[model samples]
Target: MPPIRTFTAALGLAAMTATLLVSAAEAAPRNRYVQVQGADGRGYVASRNAHRTSSSFTANRSIQTNGGYGLNRNRSAAYGEGSYSGSSQTVFNSGRSINRSASVHDNGDGTASYQRTVTGSEGRSRSVSGSVPYTPPQ
Candidate 1:
């Protein structure tokens, strides 16, 4: 081929390749995050796109009261390639110095589970575990 024709063909091929790459990147999933603060509490949320098919979600909250009560919660759902997983935890403290907590997880392939725990200022502790299906809302 003549030098001018060869150069034109190469340029065209390069342009096409660039366009494909840009399209793929645009189709890929991305992560997003948000946070908020209230007069007595704070919260955060996170999510990510997954393989142009599904998405992951996460959130957490913390709060306190002048009477010495406190509450906290954290949760997350993650998707990777062909699999997904989720977890959650919550803790509450009574103004009288007693505390309780619970945690849960979804293994994403048909299995789910949880754990619960309680503690008191007197150094006593209690815990439990179980399983249940977990699904996120649309």
Candidate 2:
């Protein structure tokens, strides 16, 4: 009877210890980020904060290449319930640069209208607006 009681007490203590350790390990959420290998002679890396289902999302990414005379690129984007927006910039080793920004909004009828602005190293900027129908992939 004494041996049986001792075994039961040890088992209960072990279970409680395991539960405490597991809970302590679950800490807070960490921000999300990703890095991808080379694509078309360039590599990309990006990161964003974790968002709940009801919250909007924003992310930033950059791409660059190695060796001499490579190019660098940066971009950021955001998404909300009925709209999305983004911007990007590219810089070349030769001291040339180009920047672009774009936004899109839903039209409530399975289509969206978008506007885009672009500026080049020559300091010229232009904007374009158009609409496109949306069809989900099969």
Worst 10 residues of 2 by lDDT: 50-59
Best by lDDT: 2
Clashing pairs in 1: none
Give per-residue CA lDDT, model 1, range 1-138, as digits (tens). 455434433433333223323333455655554444456554433333233323444455555554455666565554433233444455566533445544344456554444455666676987655544334322
Name the weakest run of 10 consecutive residues (lDDT summed) in model 1: 11-20
lDDT of each: 0.46, 0.54
lDDT of 2 by residue, 13-92 (tens): 33322322333234333365566667565555555442212222233333334434445666655555556666778787
Error of 2 at 132 (Å): 3.8
Model 2: per-residue Cα lDDT at residue 73? 67
Instruction: Report the CA-based lDDT of candidate 1 relative to the real structure.
Output: 0.46
TM-score to true structure, per model? 0.30, 0.48
Q: With candidate 1 superimposed using the best TM-score fit, by how many Å does residue 1's alpha carbon deviate from the native?
A: 78
Q: What is the lDDT for 95 in model 1?
A: 35
